[model samples]
Target chain A: MSTIARSPRRAAFFLSDRTGITVEMLGHSLLSQFENVPFDETTLPYLDTEEKAAAVVRKINERASADGLRPLVFSTFVNPQIRFVLDSANALHLDCFSIFIASMEAELGIRSSHAIGLSHRVGQPLDHGRRIEAIQFTLEHDDGLSQRNWQQADITLTGISRTGKTPTCLYLALQYGIYAANYPLIPEDFNRVELPAQFKKLRGKLFGFTIDPMRLHRIRSERKPDSEYASLKNCQYEVRQAETLMRREGIPYLDVTSKSIEELATAVLHQAKLERKIY
Target chain B: MSTIARSPRRAAFFLSDRTGITVEMLGHSLLSQFENVPFDETTLPYLDTEEKAAAVVRKINERASADGLRPLVFSTFVNPQIRFVLDSANALHLDCFSIFIASMEAELGIRSSHAIGLSHRVGQPLDHGRRIEAIQFTLEHDDGLSQRNWQQADITLTGISRTGKTPTCLYLALQYGIYAANYPLIPEDFNRVELPAQFKKLRGKLFGFTIDPMRLHRIRSERKPDSEYASLKNCQYEVRQAETLMRREGIPYLDVTSKSIEELATAVLHQAKLERKIY
Candidate 1:
């Protein structure tokens, strides 16, 4: 055990001119490295204008005074004036955007855009349309509702209820613009050796998801408590049968019981060789 | 206008043992620095096994031989053996995990668990329940479908059609486990200088989404072409009225026209102070 883990807690802020996702990720990566200090994070996003910047400054100053400790601020402000204001606030700060953008501008021999949405990367505008399209597509086709479009889908996920198919598919769509649709796997399907008949034609785009039987029982029980379907034996049997079917059918699958949706979706995309619709 | 704009396209692979999102983000950040090059991206996620590693190697070599251009590989493999195997592949590689993990281990006197699901950042497994809960909540409460649970939401979004309310709310839920619900701003509501009736009681939890009228028109027009609702003038009128309504009601809002769903979600959480369900 480290003393740092026992150290006093601190307030951490992730500030940005836009959504601040990039800066948050960057800051989280750094902070995750230091496990001793627990963080209570406040994300202040969309500081695109002077007024928003001033408001953020006021909050920082207020926190410092009230808490009697300097807050740790991680910002991705592309505008110099706003970044200056944030930096001047009574807090320890790390700016993720300016350093990277400035270095890139110098190396590339061009002035950076300094726009509000630069954190998403540059130059291509079609990504927005594609991402939005993918989201709409995924939502419409979610949970095997609209299998009519699976032929057009970049990938289709199949797993038992509560195996994390919906969130994983949504992550794939929202983050990468991949058209991902999911179908439920019934315990009854364990009767047949093959995958569900609905997904048979789309086998090329199909992927499998599995979870630990204990975790699956817990998750399913939440939806339907004390039911046979939620029983531990059933959960174990379903998972085993599903895995056997997947292996027998040569389908790549992930055990998502321990993984976040981000991990599940990313793994599926890579293992399945699905091209991101946005990029 | 630079000659680099004519640069030949190259293959880019985001390879990882877990979700490739971190490496992909790092890669997109780096590739976005240059405006001239085009890329075909393949995400090789969830390469946890030696068999998967071997498969990835074969693909890389195949591409290299076919294209006569070694692909740019961005990897976050923490296992020394997998990292070695990937590095040995004939590709220009950038490792995001090892370098940072090495430095951190030396500083903390702790070796990383090198776990496959660790990119979501260590410990306290309860995040799984919270994330699942948030996703379920968002799905049920989506688009003001069931406002009976409005009081329970961390934040509710209001905006005209296609201003990015749904995807942004979904992002908040999936990524940060924030219970985000969204309501659409109907054209009829523009006549009244008030917020929607559904989310009136939960005003503090309400945030508005605004978009450029031209962009709004483009988006709406796609859903319903040449319709009175999707007209440029209607988009302009609805946006102006909505902003006025939000301002009058003393609600904070974000202009999402130029922002990605990731950015929109992050900004809303910060601006609205929605406590991240995960952190």
Candidate 2:
């Protein structure tokens, strides 16, 4: 067997004028491609001022000196002055905005606003209000807590326990302003071939999640040790019965054994043909 | 006043081999800068195959032909063949990956893996497990449900109702693998000047949220209309008392009147100096 060599650790920074979530995510995407070089990542958010940019520059330069290599800096500052300040650092600065904004402006024949934090601003008060409303609605409808407004839900996810129904619903509500509700499918429902009575009229809005029995058993076992609910045979029976019921009812379902919450949410949106109310 | 002219609406597409969240967000950032140009945005994710890329090309071309203007296409496909298929569309293509990957590869003197869905994959099983655990812990600890593992929390948020404590805590747990717990400050807690006994020993882990009295009144009114709990007087009293308590107890706080959940979570992380356990 060949032994793997240890790679050098490099420092990477994700800097942005706002929350920096977008910048950090995009930077992580790029850095993940270079699997051999492990990155020590740090995110510096709300760097709208030149003073803050200068401070970040010192940090980057110090990291470069310590590593004996130039650090990689990914930034999304809209203000040119702040971008210039960050560019002064002794690192490979990847300006996420400047690289494309110039071309976009040329194509559109209009100047950019150069406003900081515009991406995450509460645009269209109605949309912002809807997002909050969706979150509240989602929380109220979690785990089939309240069917008071079941008809108002944009999508309803049904699954056995620990199939990632709650987190996926929350992500849909948080990110896209979708009024997502989740219902758990217990043994009682699994015993019947028909869809649950509450979901009969909402068939089109319903989606389902299934997981590998082995994975489900492991997940449940963690939550409750040595309980029949977490038994392997019980998990297998639940999953098989749930999938069979979903198929019999013609409900489209996804396997959540390996999907992330973001992936599950996006898949639900795509499969359910739901429009994103908020960006 | 000068007459405000209606701007032309342009079609913009965000294409990605995976969830398309990063591309959509970054594209939105750029599009938001061009305020005069209204963009009708659509995201086509999971375009890992050339057939899907060709289908997207047809749609983009159809949109361009109907609108009599080229649409803007922002993509992050890692495969060259799929990118080439998409480039055949009659649109203003803005390739997110190609723009920076070349420079990154050159800087590091290494070739990228060009792997699709690597950005959101469950890297390091331990990290992914920690994220799930954090989400479960946050959900269980919501609204001060349990103080059994209060010391294990990365951060605990305290605020009066309608101050956006729950959503912010969920965001922290969802995005950063942070074990965030939130406690609602009731009138009883407000009556006491000292910190709550549950939080007395966890001062450093505690962060507070305060909102404008008017805003809090409006938010609470929606839930409990015309009640003393939702009155402006009660809201003002709660705000005054909560802020006074936070100041007296030296607990750092933020005003969530205008901040988004993403912004609030990031601010908490920054102020608390909490390390992000997941990207």
Candidate 3:
């Protein structure tokens, strides 16, 4: 009879010479293939210098010591000096750039311009500029501050406070270059049977967000401790009232209590029929 | 005589039931594989409804007619009703979900969730909360507003005004849950020979951003037209002096004339040897 030990939980690191998003995304996509194995992740970006590489090595070694297994590192370190130091760490390194760069250099019969960069919407500078413009517009028009600019906005988000409003608006703006504005609903506004003055003219552009009262209570408690706003009873009252208002007003809404920001944002875009205006 | 038309500058669309980012990314990656072919793209996201789907079909038909070639659509539409409408369009439809989900269900012997969703990091509510906290922190610490929380930040960005400071910091916070902060360099700081007073205690966490004088002039002129601050001479002066100050201070900086916010944020993390602490 033979005794076998189960595979220990693994630690993974997304290490990059730059923002590390590309490597992280690529690593994540690949790791998702192994659906059965569980993993924990950390991202260490901007690993540009030898000293920094050494520090990362120490951290990796510490993790390896604690876990009794080597960690997996997906790295795009362009500089050879820093890459060499990182390679010395007690972990498995997946080098994304050097292998691909070499093959492309061979195939194209020209040296690659490896001036340390990330993989993104490449060769679309205009699209990227639009994204930045949308982000700026979203920031300027956030939280009912610039309701008059509804003509310029592609979508307007409305909800009671702390129902994942700002993050969704920012996500839509940054990811898709859609000019998004958000408005908060207060308790005083709940008394009215009709929509707000600004929203009266913005029915087609409006989208609402709602959350479970329990989650709202937890979020509010963290934001403001020991207040009427944070009480569970107040949370239930507010959510019930807000949902009723949205339904009566015929505004499309999403319940975000069980959803991440990405999921909430996705539902909003789908239900509101919002197109990405930038790319 | 036979004449070959110039491929009619083929058109492509990324269509989805949600945010369309996944389809866009996948379509772009596949399109990049065909280096010799040139194409124009439009993203039709949130096409979940019958009306929206019909509109997309019309747009696709119009593009095909205008381009004198059949358009290519990369779609992730989940609903059969919307998908049926989109499938009738005059284009080659590459249905992402149907092709993959069917095979996955067959292999796993289970029905896949058909909740129109985009790809993202999942099952990490803790990480999500961290991202929100980092965003709040970054907002509070923007433009040197709250220097008292320097200890809480993983990185601090310094640059001349409008040199892509706030956006990059916010991007880092939102995307990677990195507690990032930014400080603006005014004319007064240009005269100094060393780093600013607040950054004196933050050597390891400091990074810098720079932009080309012409680009800076263009950006500023649009922000404040016909002002001395937007003058080419003033922009050139400030950029030169700012670069010198950063160099003298031994702070690494990048020129942001051509890079997107994504690129800039990535570069800052790589060059600064910064790690995202939130996740």
Candidate 4:
């Protein structure tokens, strides 16, 4: 009997008229479901013109022929002519907008604007200003550098070093326009029986992050090899002390050893019930 | 004719089993197309359980009844049971997965794993470590704090004050695991006719940013009001000098007067042809 060969690899493309960040994310999430299929992904942003669309079609067709398998194209193009051209490619074209826009128009009884790049446009000047201001605030307040605007902060994160306070705070500010600040819990604070006096009044806005001692030790060791700060004993003591202080002060805390930055930021937003100042 | 009243606003829900970030972004982009319709948006993340889905259904039904318009629900739930429960709600359900997953399965001839929360999971330990390391590297390199690891950076951004350097670098690091660094060009560098000696050798990795003099004046005036740095004449001189140096050095640059942080970062990635180290 003749043997049949099947390739397990497929090509995937994320095309959009704007930055392609949204479509790439959506496509990535969907592709992650098939655990066995390996996808070679490429993103083509600013595909607003029919000529660009035709070029992409050729590329997709070439990839399909080379791989001996059809490629998957995820597109968020708003222009009908561009979308029609993309559909001619020898691949599975998943038009994200066309799939839902018609149904949404029928439900809302209004025609969509069909505007390209509207998703990431600066909608309101005030919202854009707030996002920029929030980033500035977050940067100025990082690692307890300045406490001048502590009262204005939407949320304050406290944790020992390497527990991911800075990245989470930055993500919250960049993604949601939340004025997030972080203060590190150092050795001096751990020795005190009571929470710091400054944190006492700001308990409502305070949140804490804790990590497993072993993971903290490994992470710190990477920064400072063969040091007391990176030793397991110190990591264990610090984590215990930080948890005690947060519990004593009734401030909410999260274990961040196994969480990603996006997960950590979303958890803070949900638990704190902070309103996103920008969309 | 009998009078009929319809609400101008509709309720929109972004539901997911994980952080719900993907669905929220997709829903927001779709809703943004309808400029005249205002949507009161709410995100219900971690809606993996049937009980939570039931509660959300009741909430959606209540909203539809109160507003006299069917609410819009954008869901990324992978579980069939949970999706079924959500579909029964009195709302126009837009299943981000159901719309494409079946077609993808047919095209690829493979059934999806249907695993929940796999979108944002740490797929590879090496990738996770690289992302954390990239963040640390970026933080250490901000504003030319140190030149110890300049060679390790994927891209180095230089600009006059308030040209959106730090946030764009941080976004590159956090979103794409790109080791990005930024250095500010002060008056000393502006006075010189040539590019900085250190950056001259690394011209390929160097990218410049320039902004309108009036905008720079406005931004600086907010921080240090009524100073020479904020003066219109000084702003004009600095802009001219920076652009001249960049042109002389043949280093590519972008204007950040009206671009958002996302747009700026995406442009750098596209123009620089930088490979995203982590997905």
Candidate 5:
């Protein structure tokens, strides 16, 4: 066995603005991308004040210089006052990273896609009356459940069975505290018009999800063993029909193939721009 | 809105060594302990060879020098040969972190009351079979039907309803590709002296999960309003009884109330000291 002992180095990160917990989580996920590196982490919240921002920068620069290290800053200082604070850090030649800076072009480039806007992604911003109405209709259509308890749902995921919908929905709810509710699209609804009547007037807020025909066919085949529902031909027809319906009706949708749970959820949220109800 | 062009600094972390993913996740979570700074991350697989270890260290040092930044390294290098390669990075003076270094003392510090030493931790000898058992069981339990397919199940989850058993089990199967089976622990099982006959004979490999009774009560109440199953009294009784059963049977278990899904899963794997099947 070989022994090597050295004092660990200190590389600091500073946040000049208060992006709140969202940026914190995003940063955390980003750091998880690196597991082989060791450095201490520190956060300075509520950097809206120039005094606080400057203080953070001063501390970071001091730490980096004293330890012969560099600091990485993840910030979103949209306010001009905050700009002065970061400008101070820049004078010190500190390294910084803002995801917005990297992703702005990518975000703008997405405009050309048949993209669904945010409000529709989060159920179309229904009025209280409409929300209650939609809930009642959902209850009536499905297991005859009551609406008194549905508001507690952080998010409701609605989709067809075997679409990997339930697992994904539950993942959102459990992992992110998004009370997602999923509704199955049954065989009878294949050609139905007006989108269950409840979803008609609320079309603006509706989000649709679809999967590859071949994959769905394989998934169904695993469940029933030998059934027409699992037939690739039927799956292709259904997928095409579903896509056509979504396009014609202007329902926003996502293709979940080849996406992990985190990526799919993040993409959906990014598309919906859902104001996270819980941290 | 004022426009302030502030670049957020990005930090990459790589955790290489035994069960590197756990260290990666923990390091990420620990960032939460610091509520101010934000990070961007990249995790590398375990360095099983000296060549890969050297290449990784070289690449990281190069990135650090090129970016004019020194990144943090959090790893658990087990193979002495790999450690030899990693040590060479000291020439660049990068901030290196090895969870193994912390874990060695932390493992020893685990309270005797806690069932420690049952699983392979950072510095423990590899127990590849237990991990394979967990993984195999998880795979067989895929998509929540493995309970019905018990014979094919390698690891089974038996718990009262809404204890988060299903989703957790599915995460193990889906994320880690482990086949995990889940069985409901009903009223009858609560009264039994022996585990399900299947598990009774396999007590050494069995695991029990318990959560805060109040949380369990709240969750169940949501599902079956005003029903006895959702009654706080029932939840308390079941949890107490389950604890007693586990203790009597010498079955290892975890209290999952305060833990996140990832934490709970890792804690269980850590407690069971199961070897990871993933390469």
Candidate 6:
């Protein structure tokens, strides 16, 4: 065997020319894929100048020297000056891992399920072209937009009692800054003939959140134990039919089963390709 | 104003022993604090061992040589060996700023918050204690922990329709691993003879979450327009009485007004001095 030894510790740097939090979150989750070796991370930010970037490399080099550390760095920013900073840094035993470096190779070589850029992936000009444009306009408006056109919401979520929707919508609003408006899909509206006209025309925006039949059954069972809605079979049927109708209409959705509101929102963003609006 | 020219660009590194995401968040917040010159940042990770730490320093030194990068390294980990590595790296850098170094004078002068290990300023005993201990057990056995003698929850959250208790409890469960069990404080419960006896005995474990009356009023106003329950006056009265009852019972509480769920949870943890269970 060659004399290449693998060290137990690996250092990673999530560097960015701007706010490095986004890159760090992505890197943290991606690194989570590896369960064995523990990951230690540090971030460097505002890497706008050659001198500042070089200083960052120096710190990395010194740390590596002390601990015999080899590090991976992931950086994203609009600036090109950061490259020189990493290039001139003590490259002896340091390894930089930038997504940009991978993106080129990924785009050229393999098939990627996910596309780059928030606008391209999320605001696809195909099926959701109109609503996406409308959303863009809504965001550009000055006065509080939600109060103006909430009834015209593309996607409306209705649920009896406490099926989480508002928090999820707020998360969507805050994260992607999407103009998300929530309508409580209540019991009265559940039996209504006309789905809101806006949602009818923009069915693509209409998504539903449902929990496991047993979990919902149990949840409602606690509130109104003897009610027919709390019965497992009835709960199961409502969920199944609702899901079937959504599927037949080609409306995408996710089961909010046993997931934290954050996890659910993250999954929704991932699946729905909702570019989380970074605040 | 002195003779030595001060460049507006300073080099900063937001370092962490483990996940750097929190550091990144802190860094962004800190940058927002500074109105003047923008600084640059670099990130590094996987620094649990001695060799890795040395390598990071060497890289820093090399970069310092090429550019006048006044490196500022903010890290949370404690390692005796880092001193030797940093000493060597300092030979190249004119100035350095490490939070650990700044904290050292205090450490040497004063007895540590803990007998051994880093001080409490790093938010030691990072756990929410027993409530979260129960939550972890429940999540690990999420299928049916309620079936067991899990009735004695530390604290219980109760609220009316859409008052944000389940999501908050789930957040506590996920973040602190607190076995937060919530029961709806329905109209019937509101009209009960007494508050739950479980809270009476375990008063320390009991806390309340209430939002501003106006917010509650607006939230209710949306769902059941023109209804007495949704009326601003009713919401205000109920909220006032709820606050009064909580105060009378000596339960600590928070106003979830215009705050994100994360902010609310953090405030609660801080108020409770709940040790963040660092995973």
Between candidates 4 and 6, the one scoring higher on DockQ is 4
Predicted candidate 2 versus true structure: per-residue lDDT over A214-270, tens digit per residue: 988888888898899999999999999998889989889988877887888888888
On lDDT, the stronger of 2 and 6 is 2
Residues B219-252, model 5: lDDT tens digits: 6775588899889998999888877877887877
Off by over 4 Å in 6: A1-279, B1-17, B35-97, B102-152, B158-164, B167-171, B174-177, B196-204, B220-234, B244-252, B258-263, B266-279
Tell me the TM-score of model 3. 0.71
lDDT by residue for model 2 over B43-127, one digit each (tens)?
9999989999998999999988878789999998889899999989999999989889999999899999998877756443223
Error of 3 at A80 (Å): 20
Tell me each candidate's TM-score.
0.78, 0.94, 0.71, 0.95, 0.48, 0.37
What does the lDDT read for residue A149 in candidate 1? Answer: 60
Model 4 TM-score (2 dp): 0.95
Give the DockQ (C-alpha) for candidate 1: 0.26
Model 6 residue B44 distance off true place after TM-score fit, in angstroms: 6.5
Query: What docking grade applies to model 2?
Result: medium
As for candidate 1, its clashing pairs are A4-A36, A5-A36, A19-B263, A270-B45
List candidate 1 stretches off by more than 4 Å.
A1-7, A10-18, A40-128, A187-198, A240-251, B1-17, B39-127, B187-198, B233-248
Residues B63-110 of candidate 6: C-alpha lDDT, one tens digit per residue: 665456545554434444554455566332211113223332232233
True contacts kept of 4: 0.57
Q: Considering only the true interface residues, what is the Cα RMSD of candidate 2 after superposition?
A: 2.9
Best by TM-score: 4
Model 2 stretches astray by more than 4 angstroms: A1-8, A121-128, B1-8, B121-128
- Preferred candidate (lDDT higher): 2 or 5: 2
Looking at model 6, residue B151 earns an lDDT score of 54
RMSD of each: 5.7, 3.9, 7.8, 2.5, 17.5, 18.1
Model 2, CA-based lDDT: 0.87
Which regions in candidate 3 have their CA more than 4 angstroms from the true location? A1-23, A33-128, B1-20, B32-128, B192-196, B277-279
